[model samples]
Target: MTKIVPKILEDPFGNLTIENVLEDIVLGSSPYQVTNPHPYKPISMPRGCGFHGNQTKILIMMYSGPGNINQRRHVRQTWRELKDPNVRLVFLLGLLEDAQYVLEDESDQYGDIVQEDFCESHGNKSTKMVMGYNWAVTHCPAADVILILDETLHVVSDIVFEYIRDLVTESPTRLFRNDIRPDQHTGNSYVNLISFDVAKQFHILFPYIKPKDENLNDYVRTVANILSIKHIYDPYLDHENPASFFAFTGQNVSKHLLTYPLNINFRRLVGRKVLYNEDIPHQPINENLPPNIHRPTRCKLLRKGAVQDQFLVVVWSDAFDSEQRSTIREAWGYPNITVKIVFVVGFLDNHQNKIDAESTTYGDILQVSAKTNKFHDTLKTVATFTWIAQNCENTKFVLFLDGNINVNTSMTMTLMKELVKSNDRKVFLGQVNNELEPDRNAKSLTYVSENDYPFDRVPPRMLGLNYILSFDLIKTFDISFPFVKYCSAVDIYIGIVASKLMLTLRNDERFDRTSHSSFLRGIP
Candidate 1:
């Protein structure tokens, strides 16, 4: 029979010098038992059976801290749940030098319940090794497995222990619910259960860890190294339970099981209700019909000579800061174009400043405030389209642009030519980019499908940045003006209006110049 030699080192104050005790255990000629005893447990595993009915001894390690009533209650419950008759549960508590005076009295209460260990130093290293040594000497002779437990962590039910027992029986591996990675932003944290083999291996690689060290996420990494243990992270285990075990374990394993739904308790507790209201019917703005007006064949908007010289460009400038207005002015610096820029200033307090008309050579600036009260910003955008119809007569087309947009002069010209070539008189022109591949269509136009309007797509075109619109469509919008009020967002409102009006929107890939790189690369 191999003789078991126990070597103990106790330091309650040191971060974690438990590796020293592990070194002693592995180096010793004989088998060893390890234990830690303190009033408060850090974090640990449940006590249970090993592979092939082998007897496993458990050491409950603790550092001194205020006793938690909840944890104690759970611990008592866990004790009742353990079914294995062969497992021995040993508790080791570390005592300070001052506590030694009354140690005899303290020992009397717990000595019968758990094996008591004492260390002189307050550092964690001394405390950990001393307890480990005590367990080795007292239990190593017959122990085939070792269980470590922290005081704060409690077994919710006996099922937890049985689950771990089954895990060990099936594999000679470490089990944990923690994952740590260099790419991850959050550092080491506890996970439910991990195996000793991996823990021991981790200890070899990271024998001594400082809490403040950037690489030192959790203390368990060191132990996992020393044990040479293969590990499996079970998401269903509840050693850490509601709180994540990965938090302390620093194991970056993907959770396979969906044991619990996220944020259920809070959602149930809040009891918030969502109410649905009936949508009001939209009415046309322009009642008058053109005698010569005819709906184009194939529902296409663009036909030659459809777009005219005089047009209204509705630029949605929710908050026209000086920088944005300046960019708009610089981009639209054409002199010969008969286009007037209509600025829709949403959420307006006062028109304190206006876009400089003299600087904008291509068009004149028209500000239409939504005056939507608390919801003023949204209303102003709606008002912009309406205002364009009521005010801009003889305007053949309407072009919408966002204030921050910078137009590629050549691309804009090319887009205008396409709009002219596809002069259907009822269709809207929009820009398309190759980068937005998901939205692209075979027609080289991007459109979203609508169930109700099988013939007409919802949000007809990918409407953003700059687009040219027919003046007749603007007139049609004038009739629909009163029915629609302030919408939540401007773009969606335009989409809804375009959808209902049956406006044929066309895509002009040439004008697709909006990009993040353009902004990031600087305004060259």
Candidate 2:
């Protein structure tokens, strides 16, 4: 069972408290400083700053509407609590047409207040508010950080200020406001922060913001892509209660820092069993058999009386030491099975040594260029099989096996027998689990079903660790799928194509159910 652990941190804004009447009216909690001193102190600059020279200015743009006394009070109260030397708070009011009379008296009540006259129009207040802030930001060149706050938000000024400060300092680039809900197309409590350089780059890349009729989400997504900004969505901060703190900095930091929830209880329950220590013991082989044994005939053979020529085994070698290769060779070094190993080597300079070692072990090697191996494509590697199969016509059966897999001699024989026994002429074989247990924990073997299968399934699955294909099938595949220039994992590409072509896929219970190593049991 997977268990989730909660991370605990000191509440950054635990000190702010409001009267019951005020609390009942407000939707979100206010921000308060946890421990840090005021960030900046006042000067001729727009906002006061506590720390000179090094101080960062925070500009909060509060939007208000006429007759929104509660929202205005909330904004004023929030600003009062945020009265630090480094922060500046500005309130902007959007008045409906013919309601300009209401703002005349309130302008004197609030200092540093700006009003926009909207007459004979039913404009969206939210859009106007955003435009006002954009204007202020453009005009106020000195402002370093900007926080666009909705009037209804009750926040602890100190906590939010510090959280923003920490984010600006820690993030490789500025953080953007991102919506928490996946379904929401727009309007979530997320912000994007970019460095000055990135901001300039964005301006150059995307010159204009879309009009009101256009989708804002599309515009933002374009900007985000241009800037390569990472989005953080915090569900906890989108709430309207005291637990809202859990929604803010607390939730943000927790989600970002802890990719996986710590399973403390499960860790204690599993204990030292987490670290597995079993090593696979090497098995010796019997070299008494004929030098070139014919294909086994115990099972239903695809081509009746098909004379034995050469065994064609496909080796999916990643990397292996000489000893490991020798051990595998001895176990599988039968006269009937001629091994043709395919090496999928990536170009990353760091992995060059591993590639070199495998090349030394396997004589038949396919070198895939790393420049084209981007985005998990292995089709290019698999395409090389066409040339191998065409060149080696005497090869009867093609065996695909991962280089690192430990296959016993008996297991190989059993797999080969099953493949030969399969009745379908265009058959692809793999192992399947018997039980309905999670794929991660299932141990039993089962036969793969030949139901409605699609051919064009990329990286064909169920075909198990190794797939056996007859020479005829290979010839047909090469001819039918001429454009096999794959840039993805071969298994997936093969599966997808097989499914599209309605290929007959068979699962061998004996090979699928067998566990060669104990290490697989603990695989997460």
Candidate 3:
């Protein structure tokens, strides 16, 4: 490795720049090599568009990292609709050797990716932005304004375009403006809008070096100071209500409950489909949306794991199931058992007081703040798995069971003990179903839309009723679940997650599927 001496390299403008240093490191490195841009007309714009790179008026660039295909797909489905002969959409990614093939596949399908050759790291994010700016400067030179947005944000392009268009028309030479709109002046890197001229100048002064300890906005502000770029606080971008906001983060965006006109003729399109308003409903399904548990206490939230416990048995429950909870506590939830037992619940309307009281009295309820409905069972499991990861630090194994089922805890413990003898970490043991067809009947409650899952057969997954995962397997689920799109069926979702994580789904016949008659007949 060649040593980098800052004092030896100085530019003619008297401002020290890392342009040469970066060029040498990127171009001369073994793993870093600039691949040819995919051969297609309007190389800068996404595929299937007539717009040329230079003629585009507005370009929207979203920054993302490798393996974030789902986030990019969300952008394509929602915001990419704004792409026309003039407007263009593209995603910026850092180069990863392991993900090169995946990136190539996405590029072939979307044709709107800009992958920079660099060592992908959080601190190197500014380098990625600088690379994007340089690309825009070269390819989309005529682009009037560039909206540098984060992948986590949901943007309404029409509102954003109109706002920027009016602003440019009103004041052509202005440099930077806060996207939060009308009155809010505070700027954040989450979303930043800059005119093309300003971007060109900004790139020259600070041509994208790896940022040390500062964030992108701070670095941008430093550049703004160097060039004396005027940053005006404008309210057109920032609206207090996320539904009306021109652009907002995914956290602020609620699950938009769309009301489509009832029509069996979805297979047939008559001319163009009319678009409907996508406003936040006055009454959302459940108040427990996301970022579950605003203020979690030790009672409701599990902190550190018990030092002596080797396994945790979590019963997935809802607030209304007081009777079942009571029976389960008396039968299986024994304090003397070596394995830890707890009930996990998502917030339910009209049952908070009862649930809180039950929790206080029994101290076995693990109340999660995330919204849970019949259709969002996948989300509930996600929250529960995440909680276990955060709180059960010393646990070796975890078993997830439904509240309606009665399990042989002694037998389950024996099974877990035998599995531990093998010294295998990728164990996902339960009653497995390998050949389940996707329900196509639209009227059926179990029906899955083709848009959500087009596959003909479900991957092998364990029945969710009584499944055990080694701590290593649970940790893997926590790491990989966010990257993939999930189905409404919690079992199928778990299957998909396990398949992606390359976990072994072993079927143990002892995990029998007993009917409700077997477990619930004489609970009282």
Candidate 4:
């Protein structure tokens, strides 16, 4: 190896940075981690995103600061987009007591924090690879891939998940940002998904070269070259698209990308459609109305004098369950002057004539598609939301319930109106479930494979099939379905989408998930 003298790297955050650990620097020598001891170092690490000793397919270590509590919270919320059990997420943090004095509580609650005493700075950023290497070796040795993600990342798009899964088979040297050019394989602190083998090699080279934050990617390239890892540039993933690359809010942008600033807000879109501005009027399901509507387009408000206070109840039901519909109408869905209840069902195959007759009789039925496949209820859910987005404008709230859920319609509607009035913003109601492990039983109908939905636990969501949502969120769900992975479990799928948008999930004492009838008779 070529020999050279060590240069003094400056940090914007502090003077010391990681300088204390480099007193005995091995300049231009054999690559190894610089672990010289320093004062005030308190490290708290975890053993990968492992469960019962399962080998991890991807190990994600995000670089965060002790002060970046909001960033951490939001990033963690976005992390649920990676819905695979084999994929593990860890927050790599440095010491800073002011913004975060109590990481123990946070770490214990989530069990995904890896803390070290060094203060986070640009100069010290090179140490991230070193720390990640050490942690993976000690805690997640079997992990096949390691992605050094930046804290700025806001949304992990479907392309990202799809690209990472391809990595398991491809095993490329690096997966850099889509914006990266052939001349520049290196990107500034933008997320780079690297093979574990490449990470292990880079960890050793990191301390020896000790490049600055901007030059770090070049060294990463060097390590890939040394390992002979295949390098390929992907064009599908990007920085501007909220469906893929998104950064945190505020003016912080990359000079290259507006000085590394990120944009997190998703454009208002619904599934397989985005023409909400078109004011096409939709007539009621009368005798002249068509029998089936296959993903209809832009529509006016369901009610003529529609205001923000009006709410709609969408019931998911089987196409043939006319009896079930009658029962619901008799029990809780009685014709009311205020609340409008609509039934979203699959197409009636041979019984099309039967549905036509039923449709003419009751103008509340909405056929989304041909018979929805088993475990693909999320499809119908998105369809329902899309119809609402196109049809229900200026609506205040929506009560999404399964046909089987026995809810007191009057009480639920009154409660939802009051809740929306009190909050005065987009909100999610019903049983709020934050962390739930996916079912691993292969034989079970709701079985979740590691590759299918990679998250260790489902993201924060309104649990029971029955719940209430702001109409805006209903539209968001419609637009967001295509961006996320296909989930067979409807509630879990909805929760995953909610997490991506970081919706305000609220639990009501009355919205009990355990029993058949929720909200008035139970829990409260």
The global C-alpha lDDT for each of the candidates, from Candidate 1 onward, is 0.40, 0.42, 0.60, 0.59
Candidate 1 residue runs with Cα over 4 Å from true position: 1-308, 318-320, 334-338, 347-363, 372-378, 431-461, 484-486, 514-524
lDDT score, candidate 1, position 428: 65
- On lDDT, who's better, 2 or 3? 3
- Looking at model 2, how many pairs of residues clash? 62
What is candidate 1's local distance difference test score? 0.40
Name the candidate, 1 or 4, with the larger TM-score value: 4
Strongest candidate by lDDT: 3
Summed backbone clashes in each candidate are 92, 62, 11, 25
Residue 34's lDDT in candidate 1:
28
lDDT of 3: 0.60
Candidate 2: list runs displaced more than 4 Å.
1-54, 118-126, 182-207, 212-218, 234-237, 240-524
Residue-wise C-alpha lDDT for candidate 1, range 1-524, written one tens digit per residue = 12121122333433324455456546762122223223433222222223234444333333232223344444545564665655544444454445444544543443312323334243354345334433434434344334454454444323334434545565545454343322344553322244454434333333233223333334454344434333333333222212222112232223211121121221112112111222223343322221211111111223333443454455655444645655665566634333455455433344343443322432344444334343344355445555555556555666666666555544555555555565546656665211211232335333322221222111323445566677666655544444433233344445545433333345544445545322212233
In order of TM-score, best first, we have 4, 3, 2, 1
Q: Which candidate is the best by TM-score?
A: 4
lDDT of 3 by residue, 1-524 (tens): 23332332334345333444445444653122222222222222343323555442677888888788888888888775665556778888877778878888898887888875675666666767777876787777777888777787776424456445655665566458754333323445566778888887765545333233446666676666545565754333333322222444544333211011111111111101212323222232222326653222222223444322666778877678998888776676454544567787778879888987887777677776654554467777777777777777566778777787666555666766776566665567777664446678989866777676655555566755677788766766665455445567777767665543334466666665554322222123
The alpha-carbon deviation from the true structure for residue 319 of candidate 2, after best TM-score superposition, in angstroms, is: 35
Q: How many backbone clashes does candidate 3 have?
A: 11
